[model samples]
Target: PRRIVAGRIESGSLIAGDEIVIMPAGKIAKIKTVESWPVTPVAGRQGAGRSVGITLDRELFIERGDIIAHASAAPRETRRLRARIFWLHDKPLAKGDQLLVRCGPKESRATVVAIEKAVDPGELSSTENKAIGRNHVGEIDISLSNPIATDPYTENPRTGRLVIEVSGRIAGGGLVLSVDAGQRAVPVDIVPVESALRLDERSARYRHNGAVVWLTGLPASGKSTLAKALERRLFTNGGSPILLDGDTLRAGLNSDLGFSAADRSENIRRLAEVATHLARNGHIAIVAAVSPAREDRATARRIADTAFREIHVATPAGVCEERDPKGHYKKARAGALASFTGIGNDYEAPQAAELVIDTSTRTVAEAADEIEQMLKTSGVLFDEVVDLAANI
Candidate 1:
């Protein structure tokens, strides 16, 4: 349903013989026909104000925000750029601001790195500055997360003007100045793919497939207790397992981090990375953390991607407060503690968890047994391990 309704093609019409390429994706194609709004062939007779659609010789997976240009004159591609920004937002546009930058058929998330000069419009001359105030214009350097196909505004006015958005609202605009060429990662990003010793090879030795059973809920909600018991149950049944409790990790690997939102995100990211690698190597990782935020847990899901199951220890907050083994709830109630999961920061319960176990209604062994059954039904346990699971 996307039509390239840009300027008309009077002087250089895209007829059947012309060779063109798509920007950002440099795929070449032959021009088939140029049509008007009602799908009638324009035959290279349209003016500069006309908007027409062009059909290609072959089908391509072209998206809405894609530019079709001549193969001989392909546009510049870059990640870093200097742009003259016309600030329209009420608040000052400063460094480190993440904005959606849209220029012609290119769009990406751009971060303001440095504000070179701000022109107050009245003064006419430029002055050194770090931010652009409302109704002001500034020259700034921005970094894009992905390389974009662009051209200098001086060369092409329509393809170089950019609109910047903050939180889904258009806040300002920009005119392209110069672009630094595409960058390459210093350490490289490729990982080893071919492996003779794969997951199946490792699992054959352990007699059980690796899995991560993440127990998450309010603090003192029996998540750790059930995880520990499940870890022991797997170990007793001739399977290897490791417990990654929140308290234990906070004491060591995540000791330097705090309970802030950013810190919590990093903590969960690190845990998921570690668990994913461990699961790939045929080791069961039983994580017992009061991962209060559902979004954080969702991030963990993406990181692990496979062989991961979220088990919700859905013990009630009242029950957790009553069974506050660490006395955190009491301290929070007495104004002695901050950022307490159950008391201070409200825990966001998993809306669609794989399994939900309430310790108030079931013992630790029963909760662990339920998880073991889930693992067994999901094929995480081998035939021999299944027989031993019942015997244990």
Candidate 2:
């Protein structure tokens, strides 16, 4: 059977051969033909406000409320939203209330997450109230059980306006302000803006290419000390640098993760993302992490690509245990810490690190100096005068 989708074009023109995405479900199909009732002379194209029937190149089970949009500009799919609504029910709209949301042709169950502000429509006065009185306007946060295809009301009035229904009766109406809290657009078409400053220009200014200096080893192996020393030295040379200490990250960004192998891998992956972002923006990102697994380090290297420098702080397990600043080695020795690298767990040493420093023998400053020289030799740190002359 031939499936025909009939609708009015709300905002944009649609024509035959135009590729379209069905929202919420995120299905992609091309328009095979555009049809008008009574066979108008316009064969291929139809503009906004015109009623039309479109046939797809492929079959899809599209619901009556499904939205069709250009593949380049698909609507957001989110379970959360922020909106401004006017209350019409005799009862006040409060947080934790469950209601039906009707936007365009789609309807879904929604819960009021929060009432940010309530304003009396008659007096035009605002209050920090927990509920919105009848005939009052309220800015609210809503959570949905299922994802919905929507746009901000300021962007598209036709698709952004919604009504709240209680027991199948209209109780309120609102405009979607934004898709809030962890919602992303379907079709994954987000484009990143390129920085106006070029890498070469940044290098000429800093005399150094942005880089991720990853120091990986067992616990208490002097990775953090060496990383901090290197960061200080780089900054002293007028280079932009940031230290990403493992303990600090675990205490904050990666705090939710546990000590499981999967969590450790995820930790490294996230660190790589952050470090690579800094490196791309022309900062020396000094990372000090145990990063016990070789595969995780490889993944980090892959993420940083040419900007990665793996330095293994090769202090032996016995020496690291003796110098355990946090008493982690003591805990491991007492069987209080499971999966402790170089004790309960294994620490996979890097086979092809850019530099190997046995911190048990060398002083912290000497190790920093050796690593700095390696960076200079690898062209990561360029001489300022030479770089300026080359740019000329």
Candidate 3:
């Protein structure tokens, strides 16, 4: 049976007199005639992906995966494949591991054979092999078991294909290399449907820019209070900022989660998703939680496109205990509370905070003023506001 492959035309359309090239298995063919749902006589009117069939003027070799286009638009061929693979396996991926890759009508058994580089998807920088663990995306170079038809992903997405299978399970996924033929990596912004909806809506709503301000501190260390104060400040300045406090969101958004480490991470992840959505819509989002893990904070920052400002409400533990604002800290110390961030659990301070507020020393008004100043300096507050704030 003849293979019937359907692909969108990448360039100039088909016409009776137009010249075309089929590549990877490079061959030249001239168009004898064009056919589609409706026939038209126009020559130059053919465009990308109009679903037209072309009758070649000469009998030439053409195959299912061969790219047919103008000679100038033909994609370059490469033997090696570079890609970003998202390892879904629980055992993690290592260098020199063999796997199968499927691209278009071609398939090859490839050896991951070498890890040219590893990356923290959240950081987007080259890092040493800690391990490509479950759910982590990393760049890799693979030696194909056999050379097959291939093209740069940038030129034709459909032709640049890859799949990694292990133990009879699909372990990873990747896209063909477009930028560097020597290195393979996937786009960093891959997310599920709900996340895509949030990102799309947020970007459309916020015309200028949007971001989340993650405020982290111990309980009674003033996270909620500071977040509320900041929200009010932004509102008065004609900005639409949403505030998501730990106590408030826990009452609804995260009520199902418990206080274990895994549960805590999930809770923060949900909040980050919501904050990312709000920020994408052009609303400044203030998230007040004791997101005690550095990894959790990094996840939030990675998801928020515009800016992720970590504000450490650096109120001393002594001061927080004295205030006994919620009496929760006392309970935690007395073993009445479990999974508390500061008393029993750990709180990783932001190593790269954009701003740190010593709430113990400064009044709410003072901290708000400082934040407004920072925003002005960052050029988000606009000139008019800066002038007014300066005058005040």
Candidate 4:
């Protein structure tokens, strides 16, 4: 008979004669009687930090790592553990590696089944597996060598946990969140555009053809002007283009925000979300904004997906100042407006643009003509009609 050195509840509600289950082994036993403490026959729930000893009614068998749980709320057994691993190891974790895992007072050996994907903590993007270095968070799946009594992390954090230890050194830490049902992975195969479009017939009807034109540049740099011109051209050619101008959107959608860096980033993010919605509905969205930051633009590009086309209005700052139709430059230079882009703040030009228009050298008509030509060449527009004729 193994002598089990089990501790009693110091402060909670369990009392003598209550049925209990020893975890990990799932052994049941009955509480005999209170061995210590003046049995204060309290009526209400047990208060904090009151240690009480209990004698077992049967020859109960348990161990050091075993947990005493209420019989009604006994821990469930699980073989698979899905977790978000915070990788601290210099070397990335590979599948089929065996590691010692510890959860609270319980320990077990777990084998890595799959490293689904790595995510950046700052941006939360699924980074390339080869690019996953130290200090990265990633979702992973693991299979335990032995069946362990556990719960999902959402249910119990204390019992649902794991620590990866390799060669007596802690490599990473994670929490068990889900149990995976073995399923086959789908093979990567190209899907024909026609078949894909057939899946969403309403989207095709509304959008005509899925397309998104993202126009980004410095403030007063003619991004809105170019976008409007392009929209007109697209409309004349039987294309329904949705224009999302930053200034007009800010006036309504983001009126509460200021021109701070964080606010500007948020503004771009919201715009991206809106553009995604319009594009998914099958309308060609023409986004015109002085989206000054590269990171924000990258976020927009990612959300826009395959339909995204970045159009850079490469208007010079001096030229923009000269045409400052809103007098924003004078106000910014006079210190009346703070955090004004181009004058007092930074504006990152598009490193890669599908179409770059220098408004200084090109007129609005010429810019519009270039966009129409691009649409025709790209098969987005089928008609050879000029801008005026297309409008009719």
Best by TM-score: 1
Candidate 1 residue-wise lDDT, 355-389, digit = tens: 99989998877888799888878878766633433
lDDT of 2 by residue, 62-133 (tens): 766888999988888877899999999999999888777878887666788899999997888888999998
Between 2 and 3, whose TM-score is larger?
2
Candidate 4 residue-wise lDDT, 1-392, digit = tens: 32334354522466667777766556677766554445433333333354545556676535446666677776665567788889888877877666767766565556677888888888878865733457888878777654566666777676677788876699999877775542211222222233344313533333245567888877788888888887887677566789999999999998977675546766887888798777766678888989888867876887677777788888888888988899888998899987788884488888988888888898999988887677556645553333333333
**Candidate 3 C-alpha lDDT tens digits along 1-392:** 22222456655566566666665545666677665554443366577756666676655535455567665555554446678778888887887675666676555556665675676667777777846878778878776643455566675676666777774578988877643353322212222233434432433333224778889987788888888898887777567789988778899978987775445766787888898777656678889998887766776776674577788888887887788878887888899987777774477788878889888898999998887777667644553312223333
Q: Answer with 3 or 4, whichever has the higher lDDT.
A: 4
Give me the runs in candidate 2 sitting further than 4 Å from their true place. Answer: 1-185, 386-392
TM-score of 3: 0.48
lDDT of 1: 0.77
> Worst 10-residue stretch by lDDT in candidate 3?
183-192
Candidate order (TM-score): 1, 2, 3, 4
Instruction: Tell me the TM-score of model 1.
Output: 0.57
After superposition, the stretches of candidate 3 with alpha carbons farther than 4 Å from their true spots are 1-208, 384-392
Q: Return whichever of 1 and 4 wins on TM-score.
A: 1
Candidate 1 Cα misplacement greater than 4 A, ranges? 1-185, 189-196, 384-392
Lowest summed lDDT across 10 adjacent residues in model 4 is found at 183-192
